[model samples]
Target: MERAVRWDRLREEMAREGVELLALVPGANLFYLTGLHFHRMERPIVALLPREGEPALILPAFEVEKAQRAPIPWRLFPYTDAEGPASAFHAAAAALGGRGHTIAVETLGMRVLEWSLLAEAFESPTPLPAEPLLARLRMVKGPEEIAAIRRAIAAAEAALQQWLPEVRPGMTEREATRRLIQACFAAGADALAFEPIVVAGPNAALPHATPSERPMGPGEMMIVDFGVIMDGYVSDLTRTFVLGEPDPETARIYEVVREANAAGRAAVRPGIPAEAVDRAARAVIEAAGYGPYFPHRTGHGLGLEIHEPPYLVQGDRTLLTPGMVFTVEPGIYLPGRGGVRIEDVVVVTETGGESLTTFPRELRSL
Candidate 1:
């Protein structure tokens, strides 16, 4: 990450939006600005990015060493645990020319404790929503970020290849989930992007079902939705399989969902609206008379956060650009039966989209 370039862009954005300064709590925005991550606690840690000059941070005294190694030069105000962070906030506010400054804050990330401290620091604090600006900054991935995401995808794919063959009809969903987790770790994953979803039989009908103790049985569908994290980047993909021979209805639904997933991926390209991809995918299911059963958006942007900007949904009209990465997942769920979902992580290129995940989309019988 180019710290100076990022700061300069953010400053330009703040100026255009009439935001004098930006206050970020300990989260993705803070980590993006400075290469520092702090735990959310009673002693609030906040990073302030003024329209001009170097950024400043208010953190616990014990974290001084970590702050010193940040990627960019910053004014540090460290407070001892015994005294709390009130003085640090006051000092940081003064550094940024406090009192009546129009501040921008992350609505989703700033906690009440941090907000109250910021409110007390400024004389007449006018807070504006910073999500739109921040989203603009993070929507496009740099080469390093794309590389990290590819590594995460590779790790996840390796884990699945190693674990899927081991799954048997008698194994419980929870047991299968545990095996998948272990395989991911063994395949060099730093952590799981999210909890592995292992649903068997009718449980597979639920989009977000938790892995239960119910054993897998023959003549039923199984859904495995999972992801792995590598270098802080995440990969999300889903593949459905069968324990035995799938019924005719199940087979038809699987093919329809597979075609929808393909359509969604094919629709991804530069200069197109995000919703175009969703519509392309949804059209396939709707044409097959299973539109209502295929709930949820086509996909969401993925990077430092599992779910982020430029979402593939009905109302999102964000134009697709090169370096943008997201998923293309389409599914069909029957009320009393099972569901079929095929997902792939796609990256927009100058020409079109490329899938980062390479797991076979064809329905498998284990």
Candidate 2:
């Protein structure tokens, strides 16, 4: 019922924007609204219709049984590889009286073959990118959406706690990353938010360096940036730690980034422009004489996809709303001297912002 209501909201937005119908090909948007997962292959999967009217589900004949489990009200149109998607889509759209209407399709997921098939069916029908219209609706999460994110965060934190004790000098970066990846699966997570980032020592300066064979050295920083997926929702969190007594410069940089992260989090609230969050953290780093070292936006929306709308950057003016959720990550990287970054997923609340990840952000020196 929650998903149905959310879909209704999206449909309303599409109609208001002059879109007669919204079509979803294979992707997160499809999985989100229909609770159906279809791999890209010879078989094609799609959802078609306007928000206010009944939508049709176009699936391979073998996958029709899966739609029986969907909570939304939908008509099923089954096709086979022998018949092809063009014929199936044409039949489904004709059945729904959408043959001559303008339909919006996901630009990111609609393949060239699918696009041609969809085009061949509609006469003088216009097709456009539905991402902008759909993203507007998905950016502001609802209670159920936030709950899913909270669950993902809980699972990620549990996995992190389990791996914390094992963190020490001489351990290879890949070893630690592998440990956490396994923990995520063992903790009931369906998938990883993204590839685990485990960087140590000088490599930490690289914002997204993959885990390596380099052995962690004493007094050098190690960055563990990862998230777990729960029921399709994602939670991203990052923490930098030192194996033992740390260098004074490293410690100072850590403190500066920590303060910047805090400042950014504190600035998050309903009605604040997205860029303000970036500025709040940027100010902290700039005051510490590390402005140039702070690259990348302050954060991004987190939900069905790890990265989404209302990006916290220099020129984004989207106002934060109560149900929106995102991260407040700030970092200061010094070439050859290591770097420090702390991040936490937070939800905008009626009162302020509530952090989903509760892992300690303090500079941990083991």
lDDT of 1 at 248: 92
RMSD of 1: 1.3
Q: CA shift at 101, candidate 1, in angstroms?
A: 2.1
Give the lDDT of residue 2 in candidate 2. 71
lDDT of each: 0.91, 0.85
Error of 1 at 50 (Å): 0.7
What residue pairs clash in candidate 1, if any at all? none
lDDT tens digits, residues 1-366, model 1? Answer: 487788878988998899988999887888777767888887888888889888888888998899888766889999998898988999999988889988899999898898888999886699899999998999999999999999999999999999988999999999999999999999999999999999988899899999999999997899999999888789998999999889998999999999999999999999999999999999999999999998899999999888898899999999999999999999888876888889999999999999999999888999
How well is each residue in 1-366 modelled by candidate 2, as lDDT tens digits? 777676778867887778887878777888877777778875767788675667888888888777888776788888777876677888876876746777888887788777676677765579877988888878988878899999999999898888889888999999989988988887878899999998888899989888899998998998889998887899899999998988788888889999998999899889889999999999999998999998889899989989888799999999999999899999988888688889999899998888888999888886
The window of 10 residues in a row where model 2 has the poorest summed lDDT is 115-124
| Shift in Å, residue 271, candidate 2 | 1.2
Alpha-carbon RMSD to native, per candidate = 1.3, 1.9
TM-score of each: 0.97, 0.93
The residue pairs that clash in candidate 2, if any, are none
Error of 2 at 89 (Å): 2.0
